[model samples]
Target: MKNRNIDFSMVLALTVHDMKNSLGMLLNSLDELRMENENTFDDSSKFNTLQYEAERIHNDLVQLLGIYRLGENNLSAHVEEHFVPDFLSEHLARHTPLLKGLDIECSIVAEDINGFFDADLLTGVLNNTINNAIRYTKTRIRLTANEQDGYLVIGVEDDGEGYPEHMQHSGTLSFKSLDFNTGSTSLGLLFVSAVADLHCEGERTGHIKLHNGGPLGGGVFELWLP
Candidate 1:
């Protein structure tokens, strides 16, 4: 005649929300410091690196939370048509300061096409992709979207040396096969892979892939969604 009720999902959500808010406050403080002391650090500023690291942490937290919710069957895509160019533009804006600090040129190429996907989830993957590009790019990076072979393909490219041969794969990676020695990308790749697989339609399943060489002759992070 006794009832014990514990809402684990709500508890998880509240905890994650609190961490997200704290991270936001810290990021804002770091941004203010950068603005007020722009010239305080030399070209080799550790503070700039700190900012990038913070961004990476923020991205990881977001994607981790998304993947957890998705795995628990508590999340669903709100797929919609988005103007490809505007989407790329908004993504680029978020990393503008970092790109500028690194003297990297970022651009987008789209063919007046609209992409059908969940913008919130897709942005998490794009954040990782673009941030990686910004880190490795020699001087330029590009984002492009187009419909290909009955699926919408979005790609992020950089002008630096491409991924190592071991890390370059043709399709979505299995969790057991990911390489941990490949710098900080292992987790990001896994997160993106989960998000990609979450999108599906009929006989087609979404996927993420890696390759060398493209418009930038460097690394490319490609995501395909149906």
Candidate 2:
């Protein structure tokens, strides 16, 4: 008898891809249902929780797929010039319904400048970051972008209790450093770091910073792309 080896990573990747697609469809349906029955969903905590959890899971699946690609050396950024303010506004619009339902005041403050990066990769990072902010924020969240030093800095700030001291850092993160024993593995941060590293210019590459105290006086997640 011949024994066959199984590629578990490939299997997990395929499963995550399918789950992501299914969750996308579910989110679309939830949006439509909310629009059609705004009165029912708007003030229902249970409904809000349902939507939020689903969205969070969807974002996690996305990060997992990206990580899988990164492991396979298949992930890369296709940089392009994009207007910062307009990009922020459009990205924020995706969560408008959920934000309104939760009574969270979300705002964007970006300079009218063009940034060169991969929109799709950045969108993935922003989606996860904003979802985390929405979960932790007290009642407000802010998104900001501008050119700083020699990089384009995009930030997500929330009015929640800031990150604990140990979690705060300024550098490129590695997935291998994640500790599974902790309840939070910081998978999203690893994926964000990978995406950031993909955007390179001359001698500098992108990186992320975590610090407390932004405009909202809370935890801030910053992505600096060179």
For model 2, residues 90-179, the per-residue Cα lDDT tens digits are 989889999999999998888888999999999899999999999899999999988899899999999999999988989898877888
Poorest 10 consecutive residues by lDDT, candidate 2: 1-10
lDDT of 1 by residue, 42-143 (tens): 244577788788887788778768767766777777888898889988988888776766668988887788878899888888898998887788999999
Give all candidate RMSDs, comma-separated: 3.3, 1.0
Say which candidate scores most in lDDT: 2
Model 1: residues with Cα > 4 Å off, grouped in runs: 1-16, 32-44, 179-185
**What are the models' TM-scores?**
0.85, 0.97
123, model 2: CA deviation in Å?
1.1
Would you give me the overall lDDT of model 2? 0.93
Can you tell me which runs of candidate 2 are displaced by over 4 Å?
none
Name the weakest run of 10 consecutive residues (lDDT summed) in model 1. 36-45
**C-alpha lDDT score of every prediction, in listed order:** 0.81, 0.93
Clashing residue pairs in candidate 2 (N, C-alpha, C atoms within 3 angstroms): none
